[model samples]
Target: EPEVTQTPSHQVTQMGQEVILRCVPISNHLYFYWYRQILGQKVEFLVSFYNNEISEKSEIFDDQFSVERPDGSNFTLKIRSTKLEDSAMYFCASSEWTGELFFGEGSRLTVL
Candidate 1:
């Protein structure tokens, strides 16, 4: 079965810098989401998108963060400015509807 794929499996950046994480979700999935796990913490939802519009977003997704589907197959998340608190493992997920989600290996972000 085809799975979600993410680029830059690991990234390191300085505080106040910018970072962009990229993913290619399962081709047939309609809903996409970005979630993050900070160190040993639980996974936290950031945003959800469908039909080229943002369906829902958590408080963690502030003005500094943005998500885009630049083309048919790519979904991207951009962090305008990085912060030490933003260090986490970012996961890209997709689902055909609202049910099961297929997730990528995750891109670990480390901010110093």
Candidate 2:
């Protein structure tokens, strides 16, 4: 079975530093997305990418964040300047169609 995979399951960085989280979605899926959960908080949508372009984004994806598909197989999210509030579990997901998401084991980011 195909599944999404994320690297560096845990990441720790200092405030003001930069961090990049990587994901590889199911090979044949067409849509990819990044979602996050601040500790004890509800999961929130960050951005969605399809056809190599941003299909949708939430208010949280401000200037500090960017998403890229460096190659067909890998997707990445870069945070230019980390903040204490940036600490959270970031999930990568993909689906053959909207509303049916297949998620990766989250990458936990901690900023100090």
> Candidate 2 residues 1-112, lDDT tens each?
8889998799999999999999999999999999999999999999999999999999999999999999899999999999999999999999999989999999999999
Off by over 4 Å in 2: none
Query: lDDT of all the models against the reference?
Result: 0.97, 0.97
Candidate 2 CA-lDDT value:
0.97
TM-score of each: 0.98, 0.98
lDDT tens digits, residue span 1-112, model 1: 8999999999999999999999999999999999999999999999999999899999999999999999989999999999999999999999998889999999999999
- Give stretches of model 1 more than 4 Å off: none
RMSD of each: 0.5, 0.5
